[model samples]
Target: MKRFFAKKVITALLFTLILFTFSFLNWKVAYPDLKVSALSYWTDNEQNKWEQLSTLIANVSNTMSDKVFEKYTYIETYGYIQELLGKNEINNFEVIKATDGTLHYTYFTSGANDVSKLVERMKRLNQAASEVGSKVIYVMTPDKYITGVTKFERGMPYNYANETADNFLEELADEEIDTIDFRDLMKEDDQYKPESFYKTDHHWKIETAFWAFTKFVDVLEEKYGFEFPNEELYANLDNYNQITYKDSYIGSMGRKEGKLYSKVEDFTFIYPKFDTNFYFYAQSGSQEIKTEGRFEKSVTFTSLLSGDGDVYDATNDKYFTYMDGNPAFAEVNNFNEPNGAKVLFIKDSLMVPVASFFSLGCSKVYMIDPRYYYGNIEKVISDYKFDYIFVSYTPQNLTEEFFPFYESNLPGRWWMHDCPFINWNGVL
Candidate 1:
């Protein structure tokens, strides 16, 4: 029996070596994608222990950016070892100690390159909108640091380096571009903290997102003469001292960390009244998990919002399906009447929740985020002849705007043909 067991062990070792050789060759052949497509799948039951072999391969993979690799090294090499053994879900976000024991996100380096680029690019886009007839509006979203407190073992409280943000907003208005500052609508009550916007994520809390909804409604009414009924949104400022979740939160950017226990502030289930009942036609080609409840609920009942909540819901399920460039269609059964004007929205993921309320004002709203839409934008717009063209973006990727509306198929506009407008030689 001992001899037979030894032989079996030797056979198993040989087979493992052969499999590794095959996987390595397969990955090497697919290097341009960094074997990113191949390595994503992890056999659910195989995560018994960390694999040193996988780590060595990850070190050798040529295409990974250092930033991306550092953030996901565990998944790229070790696999999800503890989870397979049925250990509790991991703590997704950990504040690493700096030299002085100050905790911070692994990638929380300070810089303003992103916001500066975004506003400048948006100015050009806003100018393009003016050339064509529709006006542009800038909506700045509040980061998690601004709206609420994130429970942390941290160093110092950090605010967005948007010192130049207000100047940029003023610059847009100085040029006569229409704009909305949403920070005005956020709960100013001192108690709101990081956990309110997203229980397990970096997003603004649900009710706060809804407050942004109120701002959009009021502003859209002022701009287009559309009517939106008054909404009394719920804003919970008291009882924040109570302990909840206890580190089980896994935010959007933080989810990769895999930690399961985190403490956070939570919102109540109070629903606001809406005048019209709406229908949600999901963006096709999606395998998204449905969330439940009024908003992104606790980990104990994550399905609470199912993410299909009313657009007014922070995790509003309605328009986001299309924000990523899918066919997320929304409609009001009897929208009072004359609901005929068409419009196009060029935006990013931050605009997803924003669109939830904006879509309410227009009879026909066609929103397309260029990152997800590979088609020509002008062609899409000319085909539809939208009455208004609105461009919105968040501070994170604001500077990276491509001429999403530029298309060879469309007619040359007077502005495009005439450089004279940009540089007037003493006269128009």
Candidate 2:
């Protein structure tokens, strides 16, 4: 027994020696992605411990590397937040002095991207609509930053392209383009400051969305010569600031910041009582025509006719957000429209709630986005004979934001190719 124990101890010591030799001689091979991947393990960058250890293993060493290393660190040596770490990221804003002589500055500053391309797309859509005897109206989506509710990183730039909201509106007026200026609608209500956007995310309050709902009703009455029952769908525009999640969400912007997620209270969408139900479609060949039963009460998987399940393997769970697996070519039918008007909208996800408000306006509504289209839109509008057409986006992302997402998915995927809207839009 003593001899066995002695042999085990001897073997363990020998293995440790071999590992230490490897760690000293060839560390880079063992950990090829050391900087980006191993950052979490290092507590201090200013210290020489990592350098001393790694230099023995690696023949190559960085001179004056501590400057670059310090930039990678978020917090400083004294445990204070370091402003120097993030040079290219964060927002710029004015700071005021408190009575206590303390500096007061907003953590998040408003910002946006491009607007020129969005305007060009709108011009094209309106021209196409006029050719088909259907007029085009646009919806101006407001971003979280524009709304003043998104928490911008501390040191990022807050500039948009030269074309701002005022300039874009002026250009639109100069060109005689018709649009639903939701920004004006938001500013009028004043119930929500621009700060009502999600602090850590890119969505707005449902309460503010109610104002959008009621505005749509008015737009319809004035333009299409029809009255909608607005009182039924929206009772009040109640604001809420209740916290949903208080943590670091690690949003897509690549910033390391803590976020406090909140939601609205007494939220409701006023939809007039339905005398008759309508069928909804998904991308899948199988259809769910209104009469079908057996959906979970809280969950809605509305249409099954135009699009496929996000995950072919998963049931009742899908990856698409905002519009519920919407396709460029899907149709909306109401059977309730007295004039039997057909409407078509070319837009992004901001049109989700806006489209829902349009439930009573048209017997059939078709959706299209040039970014998602596989073919032509003009030919599709001619064939459908739409009474109204709309193309819109928030000023920020209205430009070429989706170009990369669109390009990567082409050849294309089943959702974009066989999907009817993409091919039909270009042909129309």
Candidate 2 lDDT by residue in tens digits, 1-428: 99999999999999999888755544544344345223422422224445434533342243122122223233223112223242322223332212221222323336544455656555665665687688666667664443343334445344452236556766677678876677666767774454444332344544455457667767667876644533353223332122222221222221222111111122122233334333333221212222211111101233321234321111211212223534444555554444555677666655655564455445555666554344335456556667777665665544564321222212222222233333322212
RMSD of 2: 14.6
Q: On a 0 to 1 TM-score scale, where does candidate 2 land against the true structure? A: 0.53
Expressed as tens digits, the lDDT of each residue in 1-428 for candidate 1 is 99999999999999999889856755554464544323431321133214423533554463343223234445322225643453223343333322221223423436444344445555565555566665456666654444233333444333343444566676677666677665545554332444345544545544455456556666677776745433222222231122233222334433333332222223433232333332222221112222222222211133432433321222332212222223322221124223634566666555555554444444555556555332345444444455566665544434444333443323433222221111212111
**Positional deviation of 255 in candidate 2, in angstroms?**
12
- Pick out the ten consecutive residues of candidate 1 with the lowest summed lDDT: 419-428
After superposition on all CA atoms, what RMSD does each candidate show versus the true structure? Answer: 12.9, 14.6
Model 2 lDDT-worst window of ten: 258-267
Best by lDDT: 2
